[model samples]
Target chain A: MALQPFTVHRGVAAPLLRINVDTDAIIPSREMKRVSKQGLAAGLFAIWRYTEPGGREPDLNFVLNKPQYRNASILLSGANFGCGSSREHAVWALNEFGIRAIIAPSFGRIFYHNCTRNGILPIELEAAVVHYLAEAIQAAPQQNKLLVDLPNQQVSVAELKFSFTIEATPKRMLVEGLDPIAMTLEMTEQINAFELQHRQRMPWL
Target chain B: MAKTLFEKLWQSHLVEQLDGDAALIYIDRILLHERTGSIALKSLAAADRQVRNPDEVFCVIDHIVDTLPGRGDETMMPSGKEFIQTTRSAAQSAGIHLFDIDHPKQGIVHVVSPEQGIVQPGSTLVCPDSHTCSQGALAALAWGIGSSEAEHALATKTLRINKPQSMRINFEGQLGTGVTAKDMILYLIAQYSAAGSAGTVIEFAGEAVRNLSIEGRLTLCNMAVEFSAFTGLIAADKKTIDYLGGRPYAPSGENWKQAVRYWQSLHSDAGAVFDREITIDCAAIEPMITWGNSPEHSCPITGTVPKIDSANKKSASMQRAQDYMGVKPGQKLAGLPIDGAFIGSCTNSRISDLRTAAEILRGRTVAANVRAICVPGSTPVKHQAEAEGLDKIFIQAGFEWRESGCSMCFYAGGESFGFQQRVATTTNRNFESRQGPQTRSHLASPATVAASALAGQLTDPRTTQKS
Candidate 1:
């Protein structure tokens, strides 16, 4: 896919769904077998849906079971979001699930990087704001909307406007569609210049 | 300002300052495994580049190989098989030492590296697997990198790094009976939350750390990634030297003496400072198990789940965990049903781990409802376990004895649990869907896993042991 800077949808609200959302929870571990990112979306929540043969023992208690959350694009979660293994599959699963942004008080360090690298925006907000959004979603259970402006670092739901935070480096990379690899490769000219100087000095190249 | 251990190491590794907040750091060694290494090697080939120092690079086929099935079988997906083949070819073509499938020393990359003494004190190590930090247990500075970064490291023997702050975690008091390093780390993660060590290199110290065995130290450092720490380390000492003594790559005789002298000096100075400090009373910790999807959502095996309402009310993430884990407030974890139990992984599949499990299962049969398995970490570990009849004990106790490799953990390639099946596992990470999609994994030590397998639930090993 060609790299493109796409604007995030503004004022698109969804109910707060899924709890203890770990990286693995987003995608099943079995799906990690594939080296490349393909056919992952089909099994995004496979464990929740089909662990037992003939699907005799479906876990209705899982968040993915609730039909209302079938297409929610924005996920408002509890503290320490995406904790556990640093599988980037969690980010891929969330992207496949159509979740463009995650609003939480904090995130596991590795998960945050995976999200930013895959064009998923992880917004760190105050606990009060997260609680407010979660409570509002629960109360309405139907009409919860959120307005997220990445450029302004603000998330607005109902009458409350909560500012979010992102480190300058990750923010720049996310906004510029630059992953770590892309960022490093962007310095090709400098690297090439250094290599040329070294070759001339040592005759090794 | 006082310099933290991280600062000292970063300063020592700096080849030059590249720009603001970035530096060109010399990497002493790089380790690679089948899964991520294949991609990195492919990228290098695409760029028409060769490794700068093939001797310094090591390759091991672990993640994708089947631990239950014999070697050469294609149990993994087609792509996984392809990755393994590519890694084998790339290692040979690049003149890098390759530990192919079923090699006596082949096993979890992290476990094999330290066992073989490829990981030495004061060196900078990088791998594409997140658990690469496990090598930090040897007092080597190590961290996980992305495929692209791995490729770069291979080509230049250097990596562009941004230094991290340092945190010193000190534990006092003797650990109570039945508590292992796994319990200690679980307690730390639960108390500090998963983000507790963010942007920091954690240096474990104090009496408890000092008393742990080298293998125990490895278990403690292996899960540093669970807490989001950049890395975790314990300074090398006599115990470290003892463990490295006759390993394959360890220096010999005069060189060994010189190396020991240098390793002994790697400890933090008496007045050395850290960016943050946290202390724990090791005696207070009990055998712990994760109640929810995240490792941070853990509590003592005897304790009840935290009330959802009592969770950080401000943190939606905690509240969500309370809801998704299907755990109710005031509910004890003692009698929770488990569908499976696993004992073995890079984290706890060493000879000591097997001996502990075998001792616990000597006369008991696994619970009728619990399907259990014990996988050795490497071929050598398996051979040792069999020689001591540990595998026979496990099989007699209703546990499947499997070959050596990264099995069931990280879904590298092994049988997965049924959806929502509660599993008491000795491997690291209990994240949502970690064992399989929607499968609930509870992290514990090998002894605890054996005990739970017998009880068919989350049970403490201390209660079941006949001292």
Candidate 2:
């Protein structure tokens, strides 16, 4: 479960202004046939990415279809992004689609955790700041490239800058590229202490 | 300090706080399904990790298991048998209880949890599937976790999670005919949009929720994930007590009395504070159905597609949904011809749901042009429906009555509706390609699905009188 350490990410930011952008939209159930996270890059935003007649061809109007956004490595999203399903594949799809970070006002709680676990930095900023980033991207597409600094926990669009906050554990995990399982088991003594007491009182559970 | 029902559950389950709002919480029970659990179990084995407490964990062959009657180790999904076989072997090696395909109790994870009484009030449960929150209807704290979190909980008996904010939705008045808990939840999601409950644990309160049957409550809570909520729950009450009484996994004798007393206290205090609150009148609800991809794209069955205007904040999503569903603003959802109808899912495949649909389908025949199918939520539910002749009623109505599992609700290379077919179904999600690629899924209650099949269109069930 070791994820690639995230130090600094700088790339063109694609703007998706919709709120409550669900994981199902990121990657739908039909594309979940492969248990592993393989071949998910094509399924990213499949609904919007695919043209109607069986989705054989890409939809030209989609942001990713546009030449400028073809290399988008960062996503600027509205509030409550990644809002449904606990599928970690949503993060996998985004990673495989070349998105290294997401800047949003807020995020679905589980999706936020999943993103952090998978080394996809989900920077939570104010709604106004997110809007500024989206507008900045729209104003000068090529000049709108942004940088996400995981160690410092900050995101910047040229001179415009916004600092972000993530917990110490996830921050360290991202910096160290270590899965939390081994670290989580560090408190087994406390965990075992509670379980033994709980089992005695509620054996049926 | 007065505590919300959710707070009490969280406080009792707290093992250690990691940092800030994040805490290492003990999971009393862990339920796993073939899709996600197999991956976790295989990973656990690969890592040389053993389940911390095998007796407290259980796994079922749902999600990837074919619902076809004669289905065994074979799966409709190519290479899907590996998931089932891997899970079976992993569960055996881990010493975790396995509800195999032929296990009498084998069923959808959510349905099996409640039916087997594995979810008790005041307990904290986690499953790798989103609808695990359905068990919260029993007054327990249950929510979905990813495969990685499942592996962590299996190995350490605890998970590191940041506590969610709290919301309480109060419903007053009485429900009208054709209005069920499914309609109530759909109405909530529609009114507030799917993200309304995001990052919050929801407590469904007020007279309307209290009056619902245990099955109805489960049906309502089952869709908690649809609203982007952490989970949904109700306070333990007499109905919950009665439902859990005498089940195979429930405590007996003096332990049972003590358990009941403890559950009785697992409710919100009078002055418990909630971060958000919403009020709804139950009598105002109507049979609901989704007209488009997202569950938020739902309306009363009698209404037309919303005219997306400046007033609608979700105008962009609505427009996309309209195009994806091939509907225009002000388009009527009713009388729209459908090529298929599906009645089943963790959301609404319980015995009561089956009986409710059967009452409408008795002696009725599905339209020749529409293909309809019914899947019970669990093997026990299937058996109970057959005992009551519901299977016969469905067969007579030309609806295929299939074995219990998560079938057709999600197409992970299993049986599916016609490609790009418009199907009216009783399922939790209507995301594009959820049932099949290019498929247009209109979500509704089981009765609506059954009625739509008979008319070969998305007909409102309230219009059709019971047989």
Candidate 3:
């Protein structure tokens, strides 16, 4: 399925400074009541977002629940964000909750790939840079807006501008909303040829 | 040219080299569980795509399936029935192999794949579950993926992957008594941070790895995800060939001979160099246990938690974990009272793991105050254990001998320990609320969990073994 294209996004950047922010924390398994990816925004950060498991009452202490950051479209976090679990629901929930981009020092490999597939830009920056951005965003939660330019591979907030690195395919997928399956299916001839030889070489497989 | 085992596997599976560092890799097998399988299948159909090679795809009713006796579609997790039913119907419609709830072959995706010989050396397997890396024990290039990636693989039988750098971890010397593959992996994660092996695939090698059983190798590779590595694998040896000898899906007769010949060559050349290398002295490893949320926050079972240095950047998270776990900075993990003990999951639910735990549980009873549960990894493993009277030993020890599946390895809104309960468990991952609401899970070997349960406290398995 093709995802929504992301060209440039400028919005509120919520700083969740904890390291190793895993997918389970983003959307706990209990919150995944249904198989479908829809209706997960309520469960985004369910454990920390709510007063109790499955409760609607918000925990005012969480960064996302703060009135100033309630509409956060970008998440700024420490290293290894989206670590643990290959559950795509975490990315789906974040996307549903208006999270278009996540800036972190590093990410769980599987989670990083999931981000581009869902049109969520995962920006990897140096730890110091991510800390700087978080401190700057926290300074003026409401007024300070972060800008993410996908085409140019850059992220900026006020005078702070940093260029990030992204692979070509994922970069194109996020920018053009390309359906990866469709593109791969286009190479049917190559896949068939490879499989034919592979089968002959190892018929047991 | 001397090539690493990983490089050989990568080159053999490479369908095409795309722009950048990515390549189109052919997938030999795809494994799935009900947790995310239904979504992948449903989305594939919704997108008007068909499974390119249905026969190559296999689905099992593992995650979220009840481990209680005579369990059906109904589950403790609300609406879990829909997931099971949907996956069953979708898998059937797609013409893929389905291990339904009643299927004797049903088990955790990682456990079932290897047991059935569906995973083989030099093949590339992809699954939607993170623990899929466990199959790397068979020397297969396998890793976890998301549901969307699952759909893509089902539709194209290929994945656009950026090849990760390769690393080799050599575990030299012999392991101490009661020290196990689980301890080796835990010690590695604790020594290096959780993100230590990020952006790399590690080949666990050396004499210690060679001496471990296939199940032990699986346990060692299972938590490679915990270390944040792309995956971990070991070179195929005679032991691996012997393990796959008569597996249901493995080739037989003439094809088997050909397969063995190929698998024998699945090893890194002597002169092959890795992007990075680390050597751990197996003798130095102790029965390791996690004290905080992340698997990295671990120590020797007999050691005390280190006092947090407030000046450290990650001290805040450490403090949070300490508070959540209700443990003092310098509290000793050994003899720490636990509310529960569990031995299951892809990590330690196999027959060999059960035998080791049962050895500790023989003629011993669980503490009256602790709740202990043991779920075998698969029906075959469970049946084998039963034939060996391991179930009776576990039941006699006061541990609930339940059905096979990924039961309480994770909370998942179904089964969970009580609020703020402490547990010594064999499953991987000790993240906060992983086993229950604010539940504190200390990961260790099955022997450790069994010994700890028998003592009603975190007792070292080595101590109990000595007795």
Candidate 4:
């Protein structure tokens, strides 16, 4: 699939539940070697599987196994959403698992960049708002929905409203499928003109 | 306006200004590792362009190869095999020096470069790996680049870069006993949070930095990426010259005298200015650990999990950290049960790191439930450790003695941790799922890792003694 210009997905908000839920927890390490994203959706949370090689372990405690959250798309997480190494694969894995946006108190700097580069909307909300989302998601499990308005840069779920800030350059790039290198290349006409002029003056080209 | 160290270096390297903040900077050296080099080489091949300066580019195979059980063998995995083959071929075809698997010099790119003296003062270096800043301990300006950028650098020997503002971090007072440079950097990260040094080159100065050995300086610069800095550098000094004196690539005889004079002139002017300045009291630092998933979510080992209430006035990031780490407000950090321990990586895998771990584990055995492994940074480091009987001590203490390479750091190739395994490691980051899926890693110094491994819990090194 060709990369699409990122569009804000607006819908009823999904309630948040966990803190510090990492990319690895979203998709385990053993399942990361598929060479591509296909077939990875099934292994989203392989550590939660109840069946084992020997027999059923019956006591597996997987977040995805909970009755209410079989297909939650919006993840409400604690501070530093992506906190480990700078693996863009983590964002790819999360995006493949159907997480369209992540509302966190804060995010790892590199992970945040990776998310933006891959079109995963990471929203930074206040602590109270994150707690409220978690509580709302857990309490009413059935009717919880969050609204993410990208143009307006606001997140509204239940009675809470949160605002986020993204700088203009990265924001435009994420929404328009532009990277720094690509933007640099786009100015090649001017660069070439300057180079030609310089070579004429210095005879170095 | 006074110039910062970055400004001094950037101006000195400027071939010409390209427009606005961008410049066509002269590059002194470019380094490549397995993970990113293959794609870079393929791109160059696709472009039908040859490397502009082969003598300035160095390639090392470190990321994907397994380093357990002494040496790694060629495997069936396409990525691993391709990484090895592509790096070897690219080096051979380009006439670049190649460090292949099990070569006595084979190790983490950052570690090996400095130890072999390929990285020198007053030079600008780039690598495909983020921790390349580890080489900045030699007073070189080293930074990481993506594959595409690497390809461009390989072909042109120049990088179109936007000059970054500079930050000066001064460390005064003596570091407390058992508190390594790793602790000082971790403490800074926690205080500044992750984005504190974004878009800036950081220079380490003051008495504490002057007192650090080359290996310790490497540890300090190695974690600059954790703060999102462009790079971290120290001024070239006697310690740096001493470390490089006998290495393979150092200049000999009169050439050495000229080189030393040039290096001495690389320091910032006394009145040089910086965009930002932060001073840290080294005496105030303690052995640190990351209780939460991020490197910035660290605290002194004796500290408690930060309470949500305390973070009430802070960024939403604090609350998120509280939630993600699953710690209730005011929870103590010591004595947390650990499932694994790792004491190796480019950050803390020098001979000093191994010796520190050996000192801690000299007479004590690892706890029955702890799965611990100690990987040296390079083959020479391993050989040196064996010569000093450090490997026997590590093995006798029940820690797995592994070969050199970036084992358990990148989670590359086939090595990884079990789900939900809590690991005390000497690597730089402890982000969520960093070691493996659902595996939680806590960043610490090598001594702290050894102490934790012996106790099978998050115990302070100060409390654990061989006696």
Model 4 C-alpha lDDT versus the unseen true structure: 0.74
The per-prediction CA RMSD against the true structure, in angstroms, equals 4.9, 2.1, 0.9, 6.0
iRMS of each prediction in angstroms?
5.9, 2.4, 1.0, 6.9
Per-residue alpha-carbon lDDT of candidate 3 for residues B1-467, written as tens digits (9 for 90 to 100): 99999999999999999977789999999998999888999999988899999999999999888999989999998889999999999999999999988898988888899999999999999999888889899999999999999998999999999989999999999999889999999999999899999869999999999999999999999999999999998999999999999999999999999999999999999999999999999989999999999999999998998799989888998999999888998899999999999999999999999999999999889999999999999988999999999999999999999889998888788889978999999999898888887888999999999999999999998889632
Q: Estimate each model's TM-score.
A: 0.84, 0.95, 0.99, 0.77
Most accurate candidate by DockQ = 3
Q: List runs of model 4 lying over 4 Å from the truth.
A: A1-205, B73-79, B310-328
| Candidate 3 stretches greater than 4 Å from native | none
> TM-score: which candidate is best?
3
Over the stretch B1-467, how does candidate 4's per-residue lDDT look in tens digits?
A: 65555676676566567545557666678998766676677657766778867887888877777876744546423357656776788678889888889677988888899988888887778876667878888888888765656766777666667677789999999999789999989999888876678647899998999999999999999999777777899988888888888788777776777788777766677888888999998889999998876677888989888766553445455675556556666777778888899999999999999999999999789999999999899989999999999999999999999888887874533666676778999998775555765567888999899999999988789988655
lDDT of 2 by residue, A1-205 (tens): 6888889988988888777688877886556656575678887888778885236588888887888786999888877788767778888889988888898888877788788888888888876788788787787667678988988878887788888988777787778888878978888899889888887776656
Question: Candidates 1 and 4: which is better by lDDT?
Answer: 1
Give Cα distance to truth, residue B208, candidate 3, Å. Answer: 0.5
Q: How well is candidate 1 docked (DockQ)?
A: 0.22
Against the reference, the lDDT scores of all candidates come to 0.75, 0.86, 0.92, 0.74
Worst 10 residues of 1 chain A by lDDT: A196-205
What value does the interface RMSD of model 3 take?
A: 1.0
After superposition, the stretches of candidate 2 with alpha carbons farther than 4 Å from their true spots are: A33-39, A50-57, A126-131, A138-143, A165-169
lDDT of 1 by residue, B1-467 (tens): 45445665666566656555656676778999877687678768766778877988999988777766655847654356777877888889989988888577888888889888989877788987778888888888988775656877887767766567889999888899889999999999999877788758999999999999988998999889888788898888889889999889877877777778767767787788888899999978999988876778889999998765545442455555556566677889888889999988878998899998899999789999899998888778888999999888999999999878778876533568767788999998776556765567888999889899999988988899652
**Recovered fraction of real interface contacts per model:** 0.25, 0.43, 0.75, 0.04
Model 2 chain B lDDT-worst window of ten: B411-420
Clashing pairs in 2: none
What is the DockQ score of candidate 3, to 2 decimals?
Answer: 0.81
